[model samples]
Target: MFSLSSSADAQVEPFKGERIDPDVTSGHLNHLTPDQQAAFNVFKDTLAKAQLYSPERPHPTHDEPTLLRFLRARRFDPQKAYKQFADAEAWRKKHNVDALYATFPVDEFERARRFYPRWTGRRDKNGLPVYVYRIASLSGPLQKELNTIPPERRYQRIVALYETMTRFVLRLCTHLPHRTEPTPISSVTTIIDLDQVSLPTLWQLRSHLQEASALATANYPETLSTIAVVNSPSFFPTVWSWIKPWFDEGTRRKVHVLGKDPGPTLRTLIDPKDLPKPYGGELDWKFEDEPALDDAAKAVISEMPKGPVVFENGEVRRPTPPDPADVSSGES
Candidate 1:
């Protein structure tokens, strides 16, 4: 393969694995400095006082961890964080988000999953879940299929996928029995392939894309570990200008814009076996094919603890961490 020019190299920003100052990325429950600890205690108290949260929440993705996510997204300012927290709780109830995943039709869920980034069923070098999006493939049937769905259903697809990632994938990966990594795998590592995304396809996806971006930024808050944008065309800068405003600064910092060639940079963060073939790895998977399960995912089914998670919307989730050790490494 021929080498790319220095001009091309200039666009290739590498992934930095940044943590928000005061180190909130090291999971939400612990490792906060004394000052941070006090702020969290106050944050919890504020939620309790408002009665938005009755018992505060648990580690990983529940009330406790969610408080930390909101706090960090708001730059540790308790007041702004409180408003966001209040709004999110209200939004969840209004949308029935807690049970949206459980009751979302299996047929619809399977169909919708194809529209967004498909999880690789593997983890990155740091053991965070890995996802690959073949955006160039979003034309013809993919575009037509997506457009045909009712507007309400399309929006529900977004919420359902987010809920699945937060409640299901994060829970399993965080608790895998043999994982030696001390940090709970609360976030994800993403590879966004924009090799040949046409102008028409981009135009078509703009609304759904922007809405999903806004939703994640508002409610999910700080869940992205790293996003490596690969195989981008020369026009990417213009496209990015339109899309960049959707994410907050913290989220933007996690994006690595790798122009045209992505192999070298990708190898630095993801191993060959774990990464998919399209991204220059040996996994032997494709965008439309069934996802291949890695050992860790298989272990989730066979080795991890299980629990009955009954949502307020009357739907139940599986394996809701019996204890901290079950989901976290007990390091923090």
Candidate 2:
């Protein structure tokens, strides 16, 4: 009968940090004699490999002998090392630079309006056509708060807030249903281009839009609908082409430095008359026909039932009416 043989399995070792040989440390300058150090220094000078001695130096110099030897052993050139370090520092500085914010240019907006196809697409689920806006007004309070911060911090803060707002808008957009075609706002007789507005102005406009959207959602739930359009083939090409290259090199540079692309997902919209003109300018074309609000949009607005000013019983009553004394004092 063949005898069964048993063999013990080799034990596996658990992972530990990388092992560095003691000999490698021994080869470092800490092990060299004064004479060796001097000789190594000469070798380093001939090799042009400098060692960084202190933080104040900002670069490596041909001072430390052991460091020189260590560099030579690694085939490190001090001049090249210094250049590499400088390049790295430069890149870091560029990345750390703050983003610049400004209002959309009026000329650019006009150009976009002229060249880009007017969105004649279907309405979103709420029966409203895609809305477009220029930076109209910025929040004075927010602007004041931003101005108080240091320049380096201010741009970063604004960018962060902008991102937050963009996300919020996207969330709102997703909730709305898709429409076959956008319903034109008949009341909007003119499409004035206010592109020359400053960044602060745009920020203010965005603030107002956000506040209004939120209020409409809360108070007139039935009336307002939110929707986001990303890479909207219908509108993105027009908007992006019009705005991208028109920005000055400084603005583009800031965008690059900040690593922000403001890609297709950045396009946003708000409904009806929420985004009004900052200071009205004449539109190139006028809408001869007035468009009516769709049933879906009306339903949204209606959902947030307003407090009754007149009761069903034909009695005039005010819900949450202001006190006469408070109204007189202008404190209501």
Candidate 3:
């Protein structure tokens, strides 16, 4: 239902789109409108009645930032926010989300991950994880590899990727020294390149895309900071129409179809060092490349307490610190 512009001629012109605001922090609550604050308060008050309590914690365990996220997603409607919040909690339980992440095999995790968007182990200007998905990468050997895997395995891997984003990626962002913000980094920026999209290509990846869209909408609402559809073909308008319905309005508003030339706009949103070189950024990486967690990020994960990323109640959980001294004094 939406196109970048009204005029046909201007539609294909590549340009940076709307600005995506940063995540809300506890310190930022004073800036919220009266009604918005009230809605968040009410959402918190009703948590007990909702019975969305986490197993590891005594009461419902949502943080202030988490509370605001649900309320904002529903436009400050406390009741609506409460419903989705409860629903997501139930979804997590049904999917065994915590245990899945704790136990998913490493090799399968890495292989299945490549089919989804690649997180560049980088963050955008606002300190959000950045993901690059190249449509062209779907063809050839990758397509054959993807086909060999069972649908359920692929689905679980996608879930794990999101789990890592919440449990690992966002957690690492909170420690980046360059970012001088109190707010926790809660969302991500995605650039989906449609360089050689065609009817057959669309048909091939339709199911996976739809499932991923539905997953994001249902359980990860309000976690998208930006989505740039770049290197789009001339017939992108028609393609957009077909793809548009997959996302809800809140997410769609954040999308910008930046035709053939996306370099300029991408650089504006992301520093060149953080972005992949292909898109006029300084990072020496590409979409097909499997991202390596840099040492700093790895250290953050290693020392983390190690607990379920999120409770069944939709509350974020931080891991405890590592224990030292495995050394035994007496023997061998």
Candidate 4:
């Protein structure tokens, strides 16, 4: 019963329902780059197809409440997401992308000397850098002195130097591991017990001390002292493991005079001349008196609390009765 004009009118009404300006409809895309715009166009096409074909709720009909809520629920806060992506990219550029040192090798010293001689300048006759020449030039005597320093010691020194320089380089180059950041120990405490440290930790401590000593010798030669502390006999094995490779036979024997038998008691050894003058009054090898273990035992027993008497069958009991015959004999 419907006329063809009525059907055409209904189609025209839907088609011409409303017309928004393209600029107004696509205002959000104004801030996006060309690449982002291309991506958004594809996304729009996909969204349109999804709305046309899918049974799920179609794209939001309104901008303010419905569209904003949908975008928010989907975590589509474009500004925040962009900012986080930018920060991650910057961090990767700064630190994570850089080349890292593969390993600290003893031979690196010679390589460094060859490649960057100016950084490792040769000393002159009076042990000063040859400032006039750019390249390091070692005198015959200085080269001989370096060569004579026994292979093992040379390696240790070289490895120690390489570690120091590498640390300097890492601090200089990287932003990660946050160099200026403070740790709990830095704020609250300074001194640490060496006894609680592991072998690698002890090695690091030793290397640090060696670096300090070297720096002191370079800058404040007069105050430099060749002193070391051996806190316990147990640490000797680890110390010798690192030190023995660097020393000649004579130096090794002199340094490790303990030989096959480490002394029974804990002993401190120091170069006599290096000792403070007050303590150098006399060589006291003899003990004035032996330790009285009986007195020490008595002191310990006197401080002990009286405990309850216990019977053999695991029952608590009163003090056992003394012999009545012995008591009568004592009275007689």
Q: How should the candidates be ordered by TM-score, best one leading? A: 1, 3, 2, 4
Which regions in candidate 1 have their CA more than 4 angstroms from the true location? 1-27, 56-63, 177-182, 302-332
- Between prediction 2 and prediction 4, the one with superior lDDT is 2
lDDT of 1 at 98: 49
Candidate 4: what lDDT?
0.26
Write down the TM-score for model 1: 0.81
- The local distance difference test score of each candidate is 0.65, 0.28, 0.66, 0.26
* lDDT, residue 175, candidate 1: 66
Listed in order, each prediction's TM-score against the native is 0.81, 0.21, 0.79, 0.17
Cα lDDT of model 2 overall?
Answer: 0.28
Better of 1 and 4 by TM-score: 1
* Comparison by TM-score, 1 against 3, better one: 1
| Local accuracy of candidate 4 as per-residue lDDT tens digits, 76-105 | 544433333334334323322111122223
The better candidate by TM-score, 2 or 4, is 2
Which candidate model has the greater lDDT, 3 or 4? 3
